[model samples]
Target chain A: MKKIASIIALAVVFGATSASAQTLKTVKDRGILNCGSNGSLAGFGLPDAQGKWAGLDVDFCRAMAAAVFGDDKKVKYVPLSAKDRFTALQSGEVDVLARNTTWTSSRDTQLGLNFAGVNYYDGQGFMVRTALKVKSALELGDASVCVQQGTTTELNLADYFRANKMKLKTVTFATSNEAIKAYDTGRCDAFTTDASGLYAERLRLANAADHIVLPEIISKEPLGPAVRHGDDQWFDVAKWTLNAMINAEELGITSANVAEMAKSDNPDIKRLLGSEGSYGEQLGLSKDWALNIIKLVGNYGESFERNVGAGSPLKIERGLNNLWTKGGLQYAPPVR
Target chain B: MSIDLRAGSPPARVPFYNYPKVRSIAYQVALCAVIAFLVWGAASNAIDNLQKANIASGFGFWDNTAGFDISQSLIPYTNQSTYGRAFWVGLLNTLLVAGIGIVFATIIGFVVGIARLSKNWLVNRAASGYVETIRNIPLLLQLLFWYNAVLKALPDLRDSVKIPGGAFLNNRGLFMPEPIAQTGFGFVLIAIAAGIVGSIGYYIWAKRRQDKTGQQAPVFLVSLGLIVGVPLAVFFAAGLPLTFSYPEAGRFNIRGGIEVVPEFAALLFGLSIYTAAFIAEVVRAGIRAVSHGQTEAAYSLGLRPQPTLRLIVVPQAMRVIIPPLTSQYLNLTKNSTLAVAIGYPDLVQIFTGTVLNQTGQAVEVVAITMAVYLTISLTTSLFMNIYNSRIALVER
Candidate 1:
């Protein structure tokens, strides 16, 4: 009986190992990254008229594909809701999660996930209609507050109210969009969420000028890309790809200027461009790897501006997300 | 001749064949082995992957400080609180929502169920309509509707719709008068307790007198009078023990009275409405399961319709209602996990989501959450089972 049990265990181990191996090889063979993203978050991840996924998060996925196979277009974007995103990553249904996920300790540790890097700095804030004449969150003590369920915003709102010794009613919806709609329909007195989200939502509203977002930030929300925890190799690749984008922006290597910089005589530039040394080999990729990423997807700044910055309809100010050299929190490690 | 027959029988011994009992044992063993193998393989693979990534795989992370604040906690918590504390807070919130939901749902469900069978056409149709509509939609969707479409539309604080008696309603929540305890409140509470015990004793004596002498005493009237009259008499003797602390409008909020936030109200409303629909079905089926003959027999004994329902029908219906009702309560408890969806900071949102992220103890956090839920579920089942057995029909 013992011998039989051991034999069965061995067979099961072999089966699982082989299955994972098969999936890995298949992903490599396909030469396309299966990326998960938020389907309807406008500035983060959303589809265009051509049914092509586009956003800061979507670009990050494309950049990963570019780094891997030298083609930004070689990505299959799987749109996922907040609930399904982590499960999809754990099941190997997606190569990486580029959805706008907050890097919480539980999700990182318990859910077997590794957040690559902070891509967007967000904090919870409240938005109310101008007609209400409410200035600060303190002014809305007895007001009905609308919030999305299944996110950190709900907890943050409660903390804010309790800290101020203020009492407010909370109206909750499952989706952010629903909450926004409820607020629009005058069901709630105010809608609370991350400031960035408020901007995105306000832009979606029919009358944007009527809503005013409160200045108070109640919670720290660091949204980023994430991957499954078990694979260090994969984790490193995803992490550094994000770092490279940040570094590229700081170094003034825009997509239009990247090809010109690739031929530079400067040793750091050469190394970064994969023209002099073999940094790509260490990461199991070709020379000019990062250059391909820059040329195809542009730097992090470029992605941000196009998707959610001054040029975009959302027109959100890049306060904390700016480069460290420009007085922001986005400082990357030296490329050496 | 007997010796020869025995020798011939020995010569004709049959061949051994497969035994049914042995086959059954083998099958069960194989099934168990398969399950064990799968579980082992999964665990080993997870461990191997975790080791490769250098991530610690244990519950030691639960002791770490959770550098996050929960908005609405029953217990005192801060960024300095341990992950364990956060788990407790979240569990308490979940239980709070579920406990409140079950009570409200039970009241609404029974009322609506009986209303469906009422003689008034309008009342019956409305009750039936509510059951059909709510029962068809998913609970999550209904929760969203109440939180978003319904609650979000409330007016701002400055223009909060004033109800009678200084009460205010807005998006913030409901504000009403709170009773402020004065110096003699303790004495009043003691008197109320004394009144309850005295009433119970009086009721027993009244029942015994009626049983012995065939004179039906007004037990209920006397008990009610004792309970209320005693408390009132004590209250006046203690020089009026409580004062009304009505909420007054402040610069930003209402002052004085306790504030019930909109989140709690919306969650309670959503949970009760959703669960009540299921409970209504359970109640209707229970009422239908009771035989008409029982009602007829009560009527034949010259009992009124109300008495027949109270004494004969409801007692029988309760036996059928109890087991399913227990399940509905369990469902309400589990469904309260959806509080996370609307940001109620129930166990899943605060502990499992925020605290787990801050501490990086996924295994510990999830395990603790699962255990808390399991304990709640098991305890509820144990109590409900006891209640069910008490009400169940005893056969001769």
Candidate 2:
């Protein structure tokens, strides 16, 4: 009788304990971060020939892993589709969403998601076949436009057409790839999506010169990292990790220069490198936290150049994503 | 104490309740308790999580301004409209697609189903081939094929394939002549209404006269003439007022015409073709359910094959066909949710997806979507149940 009672008691205790523990506690106890990403988008998040995930968004994931575990390799990348990203985060299926998700008011408020920081500034634009002799969106009035459903681009297309008083017809697809296919086969007169997406899509075509993306940016899309809301501690850690990357870049610290700069005489550099103060300890991290991130994923500039900037095939211009010192909008708060 | 009890207790009686039955009831009560506890636990957990997130849990968001635009609204809608109004638009679109699909699918399904059972070798094989091919493939794949492979291959607007009577087909969409109503349109409508009422009255009178006398009334001829003649007379009396406003090919597009967007066309075509295969099978089963004896009996009574089928077989077959047919209609309505997959901006696509994303009320948006779908399913089921009961067999 005593043995049976003890067994029931143990079962009750175990069940109650497991149920009460939060995802944050589990993540900390496990000593690794589970990061969600886009497995196919080239310049945003993609796996290379060596099976190593590399891209601007992938770097943010790596940086967060480094900040948390002091080892960047502790990240397990879970590939997510557009429809599954939010649900994955909400269900604790992933620790962080470093996919190139747009930071929008509805997503932030209604989806119970927290935007970490803006990493890429993007905008919706239209792409048409150059042979059509269409120079601008205005020229394509009454044209059949192919757009992906369940995205901000759909709403933006409607707004643009309504504002311009153009009686355009639209065709919708579940994915951008399908929409591009339809457009390529001459089903739609135009395809509309993010300008960065257009660049990525055009590269996959048989002839790159056949299509041209229009210059009119119909909507603002600030792509960023995201986490589930209601956990302020986790939100701060993710947000500051991105900010540290940008600050490191502005301070002229590359992955190669990170170790040397740790011995710098500058007070701000000393403080950032944990040489002058113990700021890292305040965030429940080691003294070389920022240094570890820079070594593993490099600074923001290095990541951008390697992924979607002038050095890559995407060749996106750093119009608004550049540092404030370079007359762009990317300015981060000082670490001190 | 025992010695005194022996005098009073002469015989022992068994308790009223049996142990086995009591045990069974106890086990059932425990099972019910476990299930209830599980459900209650889940509900409480969800409430706790939602409270922690500070998210409001209700249907209040439906009354807020949608602040979004739908591309193809049958009714007038702007960004300023409430979310509830947007839902109505989506619901209307869903009904429109399902209603049109049912009519077309029924006609095609009945013909094809009969053709499959035909004695003619080529016709039977052809109908069988269509049913087997379409029924095997997934609906989503079929939709993509129609939207991408077939429709996308059309020529550009400048080189649009022009049809007779001022119609144009291009990669964009199909543009055709639209009817422009003149001043006399009201009279034309009234005349059509009058013709409908007159035909109904004539049919009843003809049926009664046939039953009373041994003479046949040409009900078909007289009704057709009344319905057609009245409308034609009104058109002439109203000075032949309807005008065809043919679409003109402008520099960019065909102007002054009714445009049917390619998305809607592709969705409709794909849905109808896919659903018709299932409907055909239902029709074949329903028709086959009618006994062979019924056909033989009709033939022995001097009725021809056509009249035997029209008067005897169809009525009985309808009893078997309707219940399953109602389910198919519900399937079509639910399947319209897949319109979001292709960007048709149906209810699920426009309201639950786009508006939900723009508004950020996950719980509310999902709830409203569930309610809308539930209402549609319930209403359809209710109507069909009433129909089924009316056609049900009555036994003495």
Candidate 3:
């Protein structure tokens, strides 16, 4: 009799805790989209002095919000650290993780998450003081390097040194700010991270012009947004949102010109603007989903130039982030 | 028929609820059941949540390659080592810091504590000021201050401050020459071991002789000769088979020596200094808890100050000191987790921080870490309790 009573109690507790996975419905019911983002890295996902977030990753999250609610301001940004980002996504603390996280096999399968698509193509590189007069990473043998913990940068550093048959010493910190501080204070000979992160972090140094990023690119870092697994509907919503931005850019549709181009006669532009077909309806969204994304968040190129390109302080060249038609890796599938 | 009914009849009227034994047993059983239910509920809920999240749950990830390098590892480890090996490496590093920190804290604590009780006004004020200043501030802030303000403020790697005896200091770390023992070094090691054993045996024999006869032996002098003089004589007779491999400055860093990374140095100093302050208070309280009558009694018997403190007062005060001193030791060990903030790669930093992120096994990793700390704390308590019992006062 006691055993049956305890079993009934256990069942009640378990039933109350198990929630079904309907991210879109829950997010809509809440009337806001929760986006996990890097809040400190400038030109990627940092907030301004007024607490208004502006960056490429931040723009991606805004695009997701625009696609869902038709209003880009329906987002609440949750700043996350590198160590907590995946856990935050997995635990349903956020609807979509638009943080600058690299898409890797281990993360995709092991962490129970799915990568939507690569938004910023990056690679790891080294930055050193120019006064050292060292030009190449090979000259960094027996050098102490500072890197952030729980990132692919740490692993790539070790692999690079081992492959080149050079001794390496690492001093890892929990945050990029600390790593950069250590490097700036001369605790390390070099600071290593993604090339985009290097450019972004360089502006924080006391003497930004004294440091130079090396020419060597060690590993590929295809950073993108991620969503929880087992939600194909939510996955489609995120994947097509990125594809819409890329296609809009290829079709030469700017944020200012998106309304005028929506009335064009071309099949690709009409379909992308949700006028030629019921593609948005298939993903359980309104007919103007892609149109709202372009009008609100602009195309990928506009986001890039505004956040991290020639217009921003980072001044990073669009080496691999350009469109596939223009000799780059960003090739989004056709909406049709 | 003639028996008096009142003599035995009252014993038969007691109810079971009135029995102390039955009531106590029922209460204990109820408490155990409640505790068991709570634990089972929590475990099941965690498992259910993990399954719902589709996260892999088990200890199977321990065998996976870590692929991350640690700044300081006591054991031999590379990026290719398994997570299990990484766990051990991290555990050994944590133990190393705790062990060395405890010894230094105890020594500094005793000196400062005794100084606080001194008649000299300057020494007493200085000791009191140190204890007040260090203990009132948070340990985390002190650790950061030591790591950033002090150690990182040292000279750059290119302009290392060379210390005598083949050592160099820089912001990177302090590097010293490593000793290389050749084939004949084993004889010297064996001699040292033999000398230690001989000293112990001689001390026992001397104590027995002193107890049996009215004469005393020069036990200290003889033991010192056996322990120290024998090792020195053998080291010279064996033609000094030990050689030192000194560190040399490279283009980027000082290479080819045992480099004690600044992270370890900062954590060690921070833990030792911060913990010594509290330990000083504990020692002071313990010594004060011992009555002053014992010291005055020794002085009345013609014993001087040093002998009275050593032979009469300290022994009794130790009975009061052992328990709280154990607590300070445990606090220092647990506070070593602050190693994460400065990248020292202690157990929590490496296993729980890095490995948990890579494998995504939060439950297993966290459980193991908690168990490790529990075991360390319990073991420390167990040893201290045994020593406490030995020195406890005996009932007449």
Candidate 4:
């Protein structure tokens, strides 16, 4: 009888403990971070021919690995679709979600997730073929549009059309590739997605020069990384990793100059680089957590330039992602 | 005789455990208990896990505003409608596809099945070739072929090919004039319904007269006259209270008419063609299952080949066809869930995909989806079973 009671107790404990434990400890014990990522979207989280991932979101996961294990390569990228990303994070299938997911209020409160901070400030926009001769989105009245399903863009498109009092016909696909393909085939007058995605996907179109992204930024889409709720330590670590990147960029700490700057006498730089404070310790990480992130993944601006900015094929201008000191919104609180 | 039978029974009394009735009941009770325990455990475990994960549970999210647009909706729906309404729209779309797919498949299947047995070499080989080729390839690939290769290969919107009656065909879809019923249309609709009832009554009376007297009545012509001719006459007499709204080509789109989107058309065509191949095989086997003796018997009765096959062979073949035919119908309905692959916004795409994503209620959404498919399948089986029973052979 006692043995049976003990077995029942063990079962109860095992059942109660799943997905509610400290994520950092679990990740450390597992020796790698499982990062949910977008495997298709270029300049974000796509994998190349050699199976090596290189993008802004990919660098975010690398930064997390650097902060936790002092090695940026200790990450396994779990590619997820827009529909499955949050569930993957919530179910502990991925330790962190660095996909290009929007940080909406409902997602923050409703899903069991915490958006660390905005890494890319984007907005919904439309892409149309040049032959349409349509300059503004308002001219798309009574036109059919192709959009990706399970995305905030779908809702935004509907709302935008209804607000404009236009008759909208939408064709939503499961993936952005399908949506873009359908649009290219003249199945729709326009394809709507994030502005950044539009630029990246335009490169994949057959007649890349024929399509143009519309000038209307209809919805605020602050894309960022997220961690599961209930683990504040894990949340803080993810949040600070992004903040450190932004702060590094603000402090003029590029990856090439990060080692030189670590020896600087500036108070903020000293605290951030783990020379003057125990901030990393408080977040249950090594003293050189932020230092490793800077050394391995580079600062936020460097990552942006290499992945999606003028240095890359996407050639997206840093309009909203520029640093606060440069009159943009990519600001981080002082490390000290 | 009773004493001898009792003496032939076991010399010793059988134990309660050895009794067949007691053993069967005991085993059944144990199995039921085990099943109940497993179900309870799973349910509780799911509830506990959901609570631990901090994800809200239940069907409360069904009432929430969906805030999404469906490309095609049979009912009046907007983004402002609730998720429950979106679910109905998706279900209706699925039903529409399944219902049309079944009808087309049945017609094509019966024709092809009969043709496969034709004496003409080309027709038999062609029918066989269609069945073999279609049923072998995967359904998803067929759907993609239809959507991408066939339909998308049509002309662009600006270069739309014009069809008769103010219709246009483009890669986007087929655009046709929508019929708008004006004020006195109700009377015309009522007249048609009355005509249908009159035809059914006339068919029954004609069948009875043929049984009573040896003279056969022209039931087909009269029924057609009652159902179609009466409606047409009434429509003309009522001064044609229906007008068509023709589509106008605009700068960006062809606007102001009913449109059949290519995604829906492609899904319908793919499902019908693919399912028809299997249905044809089932039909062929069913017809072959009726022995040559039946055909010989019909031929010996002074009946012609067409009448023999239609009256004698088909009725018997139906008994064999129905059980498998029910399964095919169920398969077609369930396979319509693949609408998500091509973005047709069926129940799986709308409720399970979009709503589940928006609400982040995976457990609730998935459970509801499963329950819905279960109900649909069971309901289909129920109706098919009833029809089967009505036509089933009664034995002594």
Best by DockQ: 4
- RMSD from true fold, candidate 2: 7.0
Q: What is the fnat value (0 to 1) for candidate 4?
A: 0.52
Order of all candidates by DockQ, from best down to worst?
4, 3, 2, 1
Better of 1 and 3 by TM-score: 3
Error of 1 at A145 (Å): 7.6
- For candidate 4, lDDT tens digit of each residue in A176-216? 87888888888888999999999999999987999999999
State in Å the error of residue B101, model 3. 0.7
Per-residue accuracy of model 3 over A207-234 as CA lDDT, tens digit each: 8999999999999999999998778888
Tell me the DockQ of each model, to 2 decimals: 0.20, 0.26, 0.36, 0.38
TM-score of each: 0.80, 0.88, 0.94, 0.95
Please say which candidate is ahead in lDDT: 1 or 4. 4
Error of 4 at B197 (Å): 2.2
TM-score of chain A, cand. 4: 0.94
Number of the candidate with higher DockQ, 2 or 3? 3
Docking class of 1: incorrect
> Residue B213's C-alpha lDDT in candidate 3?
94
Question: Per-residue lDDT for A1-336 in model 1, tens only?
Answer: 112222332332232433233433455687788999988888989999899888999999988888888999999999875544554565456889988788888777666678999999988898988887888878887666777654667667766777887666565554677678767766567888888888888888999999999988888899999987666667777887898899899888999999888877877778778887788877766776788899999999999999999868888888999999889999877566
* Predicted complex 2: CAPRI docking category: acceptable
**C-alpha-based local distance difference test score of model 4:** 0.88
TM-score of chain B of each: 0.87, 0.87, 0.95, 0.96
Full ranking by TM-score? 4, 3, 2, 1
Candidate closer to the true structure by DockQ (higher is better), 1 or 2: 2
Model 4, residue B74: displacement in angstroms? 0.3
User: How high is the TM-score of chain A in model 3?
Assistant: 0.94
TM-score of model 2's chain A = 0.90
Backbone clashes in model 2: 3
Model 4, B231-314: lDDT tens per residue? 889888889999999999987788878989898999999999999998899899999999999999989989999999889899
